[model samples]
Structure formats: C-alpha cells, structure tokens
Target: MLGISFFSVVSFLLVWELACRNGVVDPIFLPAPSQVLERAVRMFTEGTLLWHALASTRRVMVGFLVATMAAIPLGILMGTSQRTRAAFDPILSFLRPLPSMSWIPLSLLWFGITETQKYSIVFMGTFAPALLYVIDATRSIDPLLIRAARNLGANRWQVMREVIMPGSLPQIISGFKVILGLSWTCVISAELVAAKEGLGFLIMNGKEFFQTDTVVLGMVMISLTVLLTDIVSRVIEKRILKWQA
Candidate 1:
C-alpha cells in the first residue's frame, strides 16, 4: 500500500509537471508542481503558512469537538427511546439536507464576521449528520444484548453506559472521521465569506490576483492536514476499541 501510494504520488507530480511544460494545460489556471513547491517553501520560511494552518486547525477542532460531544448524547437518547426520536425527527429531517453553505448567512448574523462565526458554521454543518450517524450506530446494537443486560439486573442507565456506548463506539468514531473531513469543506466555505487567514482564504485571495501556485498550495495543505487528522483519529480508534476488530 505504501509503495503504491508513493509511486502514484510521484507519477501524478510527473504528469502535472509534464502537462505544464508541454502546454497541454494553461499555467494561469494550473501552476507547475515546481511553482507550487517553491511557493510552499517561501510561505514556510516566511511563517505565514503555519499561521494560517494553525488558525484553521483551531477552528476545525473547536467545531468538530463541540458537534461530536453534543451529537452522541442526543443521538443515544433518540436511538434508545422512540419518544425522543419522534420529537427530534422533524427538525433533523429539515436540517439533514441543508449543506454547510446554507448556515453562512445565519452564522454571520448570530456570531458576526469572527472566528466564532466560522466555528458555528462548521458546527451546524456537521451536527445533524453526526447525530444521525450516532443514532444509526446505536440502533445497530442488538436488542438481545439489551434484554440480557436487563435480565441480569442492569438498570437503564447501566445498560446504556456499559453496553450501548461500547457497542456503538466503533461506528461513532468512524462517523466522526467522515464528519471531520466534512468540517474542512465547511471551513473553506466559511472562510470564503469573511476569513482573512486560512487555507480557504489563501485560495480565494490567490484567485483575485491569479496566483495559481497559492491556490494549489491551499488545496495541498487541506489534503495534508486532513491526512494528519485521520492518522490521529485512527490512533484514537485503536486505543478506544482495542477489544473489537
């Protein structure tokens, strides 16, 4: 797998470089790999790249963490009890189809054009979907296990804490991984509106000046950051669900 990935990446770079050199594509729209790398090195040396990355990372973490924390309990409640599901279903139905872009107007109104507003945009974008993932995870647990726990004198809370939570954890973690990636997309959309410093801002700003290298750098940074976060999530998942497959 590592070999394939490495070779594929090298091949892609070669293709990209060749395309630009042969005039198969316009450099104005797509800069050469060397240009992107040069820009990346310059930004790194100047320290602006790290600052923008840090700002976006902080926003993603805050939004994703808050959204995940809120979703789990509500989702469990909805999954374990039909009454709660009935009450929340309509709202969920309405919110589920709405993309992250839809929240920009309301988020701007609620939190203004600040980092908090950006966080809110990501949070709202990810919340409903995360909740649904948790609910589905919880519902996938076996009813027989719940019955067995009950027969063994386990209280409702105890069953939930011991059985349901553990059984659903793997799925919940997996779902959060998906949501984390979604949060990046949300961040870009959010930044497109009012951000001054972030990968998304870098891309939009570059577009205004026709600097394709910066735009490519922004895209590459997002991919690298997402890959790093995915590694961290995988570590957490391994630790938390070590007993499971």
Candidate 2:
C-alpha cells in the first residue's frame, strides 16, 4: 500500500509537470511541480517557511490542548449527570455550528490581534465538538460495566478514574485526532486577522503578490503538516490503547 501510494503520487506529479511544460496547463494557474519545489527550496533557504509553519503549529497545539483539557472533565460530567448535560447542552448546540470565521470580529476586539486571539479561534472552533465527542464516548460505555464496578465496592471517583476513563479513552483519543486537524483550519482563519507569520498569512501574502508558486507551496506545507500530526496521533493512540488490543 505504501509503495502504491508513493508510485501514484510520483506519477501524478510527473503528469502535472509534463502538462505544464507542454503548455496544456498555464503555469500562471497551476505551476509545474518543479516550480513549486523551487519555491519550497527558496523559502526554506530564507527560513520564512519554517517560521510560518512553526507559528501555526504552536497555535494549533496550544488551542487543541486547552480545548481537550476543558472538554474531557466537562464531558465526563455531562455524560454522568443529566442535570449537568441539561445546563450546558443548549448553549453548546448554539455554539457548535458557528465557524471560527464568525468569531473573528469579537476575538479581534477582545484580544487585539495577539496570539491569544489566534488560539481562541482554534479553541472556539474545536471545543464544542470535542466536548460532544467526550460525552458520547463516556455515555457509550455499558451501564453494566458501571454497575459491576460499583458492586466491586468502587466509589464514584474510583469508578470514574478506573472504569469510565479507560473504557472511553480510545474513542476520546480518536475524536481528539480529528479535532486536532480542525484546530489547524481554525488557525488559518486566526492568522487571517493581522498575523504577519503563518501558513495562512503566507498564502494571503502570495495572493497579493500573484505568486502562485508560493500559494501552492503554502497549501502543500499545510497538507504535509497535517499528515505529520496524524501520524503522531496514531503513534500516541497505539501506545495508549495497546491494552485494548
């Protein structure tokens, strides 16, 4: 599968490069693979690309960790206590569908173009979904399991810490992997507001200068970063969930 995937990507790039060289596709619109690669090298040499990518990565991690930390405990409470769910569910529903872009005006006003605003964009975008994922994961654990824990003389906190957490963790981690991807998207929107450095800013700046190679380079960098993070997440999941297997 890995070999096939590599071959497929190489073939596609070959076709793309040939098409551009033969003028079937305009370089202005879709630059050759070589052209994009050249641009990548130039940016790397100048150190701008690394800095931009790092900025976005930092924002994503901070926002995602904050959201996860807040969501897990609250979601566990919501799953176990009907009254708690009732109190938060209404507002969460309202906030869930709202895009990160929608909060830019208020975030800008509140945080004034600082990194906090960028992190807030990511946090706001992912928090509700993460909360819901945690809630569902906890609730989906069998009630029989809970009863068995209790019958074994486990207290509420012990049942939660030992039984509930382990039972629900696989699903929670899976959900967080998705939410981490979402944080990257929100960071793009975040960097749209007065950010001088980030992949988002790079793309926007390239557009103003009509540097299609830079734009494509920014996009490619985003795809690579997301792929890297996904791999890291899978590694973490494997280690943590090895017991289940």
RMSD of each: 1.1, 1.0
* lDDT, residue 69, candidate 1: 93
State each model's CA lDDT, in order: 0.94, 0.94
* Cα lDDT tens digits for candidate 1, 12-128: 999999999899989998999999999999999999999888889889999999999999999999999999999999999999999999989888888888989999989989999
Q: What would you estimate as the lDDT of candidate 1?
A: 0.94
Q: Which pairs of residues clash in candidate 1, taking residues 3 or more apart in a chain or in different chains?
A: none
Per-candidate TM equals 0.97, 0.98
Candidate 2: segments with Cα more than 4 A from true spot: none
TM-score of 2: 0.98
